[model samples]
Target chain A: MTAEYFMVLGLLGVAFFSVAGALLGYEKSISGFGVVVVATVTALGGGTLRDILLDKPIFWIATPEYLYSTYAAIIATIFFVRYLPHVNNYYFLLVDAIGMALFNIMGIEKALISGTGMVIAITMGITTGIFGGLIRDVICREVPSVMRNEPYASACLAGGLVYAALFTIEVDYIWCILGSLFTTVFLRLGSLHWGWHLTIFRKKDFKNQSD
Target chain B: MTAEYFMVLGLLGVAFFSVAGALLGYEKSISGFGVVVVATVTALGGGTLRDILLDKPIFWIATPEYLYSTYAAIIATIFFVRYLPHVNNYYFLLVDAIGMALFNIMGIEKALISGTGMVIAITMGITTGIFGGLIRDVICREVPSVMRNEPYASACLAGGLVYAALFTIEVDYIWCILGSLFTTVFLRLGSLHWGWHLTIFRKKDFKNQSD
Candidate 1:
């Protein structure tokens, strides 16, 4: 697949996750302003982090297409707010995971192209992949799935490593993207299917305080 | 003051907030690893977001002093975990506000130096000021004060505007810093003293769902 194809996929990912973010916001008493902000944050937050860390001009600033995409997503969400009820019930994980899978490869490739080491590339990939949803979930006032038992960040990590390994072995770059994408989507889907979860540990005397 | 002075002050801010972050971590059943990660994230999260959005190399990568300070703070927290209970009682707000005030100016200056517009500079200032604490609270499973009715981000916003206005009027940079500093600190202190908070409005049919 061409980079343009990936870019299109990434844009779709942005739209999907922004809708998810807007839905998350709507569950609360989030106003229209809040919905727009949350949608943009969810769609662009991770890539913004990646671009900033790479010390490159932020992607959206250079290419207004991304911002336009986020705006479009927010507008779509606002118009369809009433139809967003079951959004959190089943659609959240799928859209988020798909977006994560696409963004993960994009971040790894960007980091590698910028001449970072393999470890940093992989870590950057995961950071770019999950950061948006992490911030979105946090803004929505829930524990991030990565911090909880969900296999979110771990899937990104695994897929990033797969991409790195493939790229290192002189595999076709397209294959690398596909391989990594499938790994992430399958891992997340498999986890959901089997109810796989990470274990939580606490101090011997964990105190739960209500704020 | 000299750049070195700001550097020192920034490091001190990082240490103090890392201590505060670890204390927050300890209040839960978070393990030592969790404590360390939370400390690092809280100490560096805001600046990381700022630098990234500004398209600069992260403040910590070029200078490891900040990370070392965070480490020192986390080490202190680990050894003194037994004494962290009272940390959340009264000290949390003071230390967090002080850190926010300092970091707020630092962000504004950095943005100004980067040649961003006044609006972006102010936004970045507030972003840098409160992002760490916001993430810290979220990670610690509490609502971020700024998200609710707290005057935290508002103080930073007011102080950032003060700094921007002073700079626009060609005031001495040191005076700008001090002016903004006092504004944020005094505003926060006043808010705490008089129980000032923003009024929240929930939509009549808001739905609460666990994600």
Candidate 2:
């Protein structure tokens, strides 16, 4: 509704994703400190990349509140998941979709305001939405879901394209933001519900080699 | 050596890592274009992070030659590795060590010149050295070697500390660079030769959870 409102939602998104990240690290048998590190990376990694590419100060470094929120969420989730068992499993997709939608739209807005072209703006949006999970998966020694046949980055890309197109057509900023966020969340949730996936292609003669 | 000499060596280091990245992507059966992307990420990912954290213009975007070098090296490696299967395997560690040493020292020098304190400078140096490989490994669905028991980041840390300590003691700039480079390369190569590795630790009661 308002910039301030969006900011608060964005921080909530960061916290939700931190829970996912911490749970992931817990699965890997990481230590307490290590789980915190992994969760922080998962929460802030995408925004950090977007800001860096835009040559802006890193978002978390510029706003300590995001870091604080991430830690707070991580602590809460650790206890909740530890006691509840299966809570994280049930809510992972919902949290992931909400976080992706919030971060993706915010990234597009930041890139547009920075005067980048629509394509770069959209690219930045997708980067901000997906890279945090990608980095977390890497650290936890898993292939990123985005790289699989899942509709992860594709959902971000669709949302980014929608936002850019709406902005280009002189849509109001609020409507543009809302439109994009809805697109991302809807697509992500729908895909998960229906088991929709992207297709993978490879060369006919390509041989898999273990290096 | 001269600054110009180090600059040339740095570009070569980028090229070497590009080859390693391309080879890894090839092992994963990535498409031709995907290999190029992965290789470029592996080569430039660290320096990009360094420049961003330092709030400076991205080095590759500022100097397009680095991008050109990455592309050229990726193409070369693709052709080279396709025909010569064992080549990448034999040369991977050497190329990685050289690249790490060059990038690590350059990062330290850049941070010091940027007026950052010694600790930040050293941290930036390690970030520049290892983040590229870390990102690359993540994209390729492998756990980063640095996050494992490997001495990868530890070598960078050791080198960064050496450089900062030398510079603090009023060592000549050239000597500082040389000292750090030698330290990194020696430790990395020696670790491989002697099978030395960092230790992993976890809580006694930590139970592995599958998420």
Best by lDDT: 2
Model 2 CA lDDT for position B174: 80
lDDT tens readout by residue for model 2, B1-211 = 3668657867987898898787676667664344554677789899988887887877765566777788789878767665565554548778888888888987887787789988898899899999999878768767788867668888999998888788779877788878888999899889888888876675443555432
Worst 10 residues of 2 chain B by lDDT: B202-211
DockQ of 1: 0.18
lDDT of 2 by residue, A57-159 (tens): 7878888898889999999978887787656544777887888888888788777777766666776787788888877877787866665555777788889
Model 1: which residue pairs collide? Answer: A203-B29
True contacts kept of each: 0.27, 0.18
DockQ scores of all models, one per candidate: 0.18, 0.15
List TM-score (chain A only) for every prediction: 0.86, 0.88
In angstroms, give how far residue B127 of model 1 lies from its true place: 7.9
Question: Which CAPRI level is candidate 1?
Answer: incorrect
